[model samples]
Target: MLSVRSAAVRAQCPSCGTWSSRVQSSYRRTASDLPLSGRAASLAERVRRFHCDGAQRTRRIFAERHGEEILAPFARRTGRLEIVVHHLGLALGGGPGAGFARRLQVPVSNDTLIRVVRRRATAKAYAPPRAVGIDDFAFRRNCRYGTIVVDLENRGS
Candidate 1:
């Protein structure tokens, strides 16, 4: 296990975007990180909660926000580790990715990998098709027919 902590004494409010240093409380959050020395690693982070004194805002208290590139809010893994999992799931698929991760000293389940892939797929933005092509195919020599639509620009069907 690797211990870590945010060095910033102040954090910006997610609602009112005000920087605050008055700490109301602190807590520790543990998350999975990249492997170290060919072994799975975890990060124990010391997180701080601040009292949002913004009188105009509805939120009276909020947790400190870390850099998105470093660690996402309420995430179970570090950003870099999540990126590795994402690529592994995308390239090798769920079961294979999970197996490969185990070999690399990364602890992950096949279902988790599948979920990561699904999340990534939903998050990605696809460009609108500029042109499309349609065709009909027979599955059983005229007994069953199906229609197929293809994006001409992206070459996706």
Candidate 2:
């Protein structure tokens, strides 16, 4: 089982540019991931509420970080599980992705995977391009070809 421990650390307040030690609060969250060898990987993180001594009178609760990882800010599974799900999602497609997760004893819905794929596709479609250059490529071997519009402003195709 994953357990969270409070540690002393300095954090910057988003409301004000004041740096101070974050105070621990009675808040905790645990996220589970796909099991490994009949055991599941879980993350236990502590949440803290901080008091800022800046000009603004505000208090903020910040999630503690473990090493190079940030928790609570975004929902995520374990590193290994994430890798497996990503690869399976890409290889098996969205429909089979959810099935793969079920086989692994991980709770994942098909709609979630579909939504993820759609969002990714939309993001890629509207991605910005760095350099813009026109190049001619054959659409079909020797049948059709057209000039591709390359956006040079953002380095995206």
Candidate 3:
């Protein structure tokens, strides 16, 4: 476990780009970072809530921009960790990715890895084909069937 205590006072508003020293509230959050020495490390990061004083934009309150560069929004693990996880998920499929992550001491589930890959893939812009071919495929050999839509123009996917 990685123990962290609060440091630094920040007053910058992310949305409006204004600065202030007024403190609305202070709190601490638990975060999971990258593995250290083949062991999982966690953090007790201190966070601060600030009242937005900027008049340019209209957000009443804003949280401190602490670790925003290092961590993804609402994410426990650091951005670097997530990047490593995403690469693992892409190289190895879900189950294998999870197993590999365990070997790397990340300790994440297959579902989590799958979700990570999905999120990263969805971030890119894509143009869907205008036409598609629809067919029914045997999802299970004589038990069930599912509809499959194939991109007609591309002939792939």
Candidate 4:
């Protein structure tokens, strides 16, 4: 367990983009961090809620922005911890990755690991075949016919 706080005197409002030093209230947020010395580790941060002073009718009160590079809003785990989990899910898959994460003192479910993989997936663009080669073959005395398509550019089927 580790306790910390942001040293910045003021934080910029995410909605209005105005820097505010007026602190409305403060709260503590906990997030799971990487293991330390083979033991589970956690970080407790004292977050401050600021009153937006911008003229724009945006949010009245907003919490201090903990940059996404460190931890995302409402995230239960640190950014680095999530990265490790993402890699584990990609390498070992859901079931095995969850088991490995448990061995590393990271508490995560197999379903969560699977969700992480799905959430991070990106759609790949499909390209039309540039050069195609089509051929027909007879299985037995022209009784059965089969067609084979190959990409002539890459020389692959």
Candidate 5:
């Protein structure tokens, strides 16, 4: 049983970016949260599904946008928690990151940690550079070669 529960109301649909007062349905979402006082915490988020206004949107219904700082759709952990876990995964390897999460009372596996890191990394937006530097290097013993493209503005690949 969840100790804490609440309902969220949103006048806007994130998908279609339109307002809809007609609630299609609602559901409870269990989001793992940061541990409190050495005990694991979670939230029974009563998420509302709103009927999208007819604006040529593909999705007829869209779930209410929850606190973006808290979590996202289909996310198990809070956004802040995921950020910390991602940092841990970046600092440590997969196996070590898993072990660290266990100690932190965040039940995350090695595979989950890897996924977190990959997701956050890909979610970032990099500004397009005016010019890019391209270089070629042999990847294998005179067999395979790979091209390295570096952004001149950010010096990132």
Candidate 6:
């Protein structure tokens, strides 16, 4: 399963728009999902490093998918790490995102999680607009209000 996914993922390199056919190595990574009760849902994936023959050198390795899911590369804790960071942002008001990193067996920083979230938000905000709408929301929880612009063109919100 891993080999197949790796092969499929390595077939295309987004950086150079070239098809990769040579695989150098393979490995396994595990990731965690949202908690079920007090436990977390985990997934293990096989990853591969590919040799890119394209110009303008870029990343040589990427993850493949088993069935419908894309697996993470390098480590098994990617999912858990993301969850921790997201939860930290919501629970501790984003300031303790870094502190949560220290709690992980593997080291991470709050700044990294903040950066990831910011990047995702920026990407979504700047995505090409198809349809636009305007709405109003509370600015201060029943005290004030403001207008919000929404893009309804995209499928995912």
By lDDT, the best candidate is: 1
C-alpha lDDT (0 to 100) for residue 19 of candidate 2:
76
Give the Å shift of residue 104 in candidate 6.
14
Work out the TM-score per prediction. Answer: 0.77, 0.61, 0.69, 0.75, 0.68, 0.44
Name the top TM-score candidate.
1
Candidate 2: stretches off by over 4 Å: 4-8, 22-24, 58-69, 72-84, 119-126, 131-157
**What order do you get sorting by TM-score, best first?**
1, 4, 3, 5, 2, 6
TM-score of 1: 0.77
**Candidate 2 lDDT over residue span 1-157, tens digit each:** 5776666677666676687684755577676666756655676766666667677656555434454234435656554455555566666877788887787776667776665556546756665566679999999999799998877676521
Model 5, 1-157: lDDT tens digits are 2433335344676666788888988788888887877777786777777888867877888877666677777888877778878888898969998898888888789998899889878888766788889999998889899999987778632
Flag clash pairs in model 5: none
Worst 10 residues of 3 by lDDT: 1-10
Q: Please count the clashing residue pairs in each candidate, in the order shown.
A: 0, 8, 0, 0, 0, 2
Q: Assess each prediction's global lDDT (C-alpha) against the native.
A: 0.87, 0.64, 0.78, 0.86, 0.78, 0.57
Looking at candidate 4, the ten consecutive residues that score lowest on lDDT are 119-128
Per-residue accuracy of model 1 over 1-157 as CA lDDT, tens digit each? 9887888889988889888899999899889999999989998878898988786777878898677566788889988899899889988999999999999988999999989889877876788888999999999896999999998888621
Global Cα lDDT for candidate 6: 0.57
Instruction: Report the Cα lDDT for candidate 1.
Output: 0.87
Candidate 6: tens digits of C-alpha lDDT, residues 36-111: 4444455556666667778766776643334322433443445445655656665565456666545543244666
Per residue, candidate 3 scores C-alpha lDDT tens digits across 1-157 of: 6655446565788888888677898777776778888898876666678888898768767877556546545787777788888888888989999999999889689998899889877875567889988999897799898999888777631
lDDT of 4 at 70: 74
Clashing pairs in 2: 129-154, 129-155, 129-156, 130-152, 130-154, 130-155, 131-152, 132-152
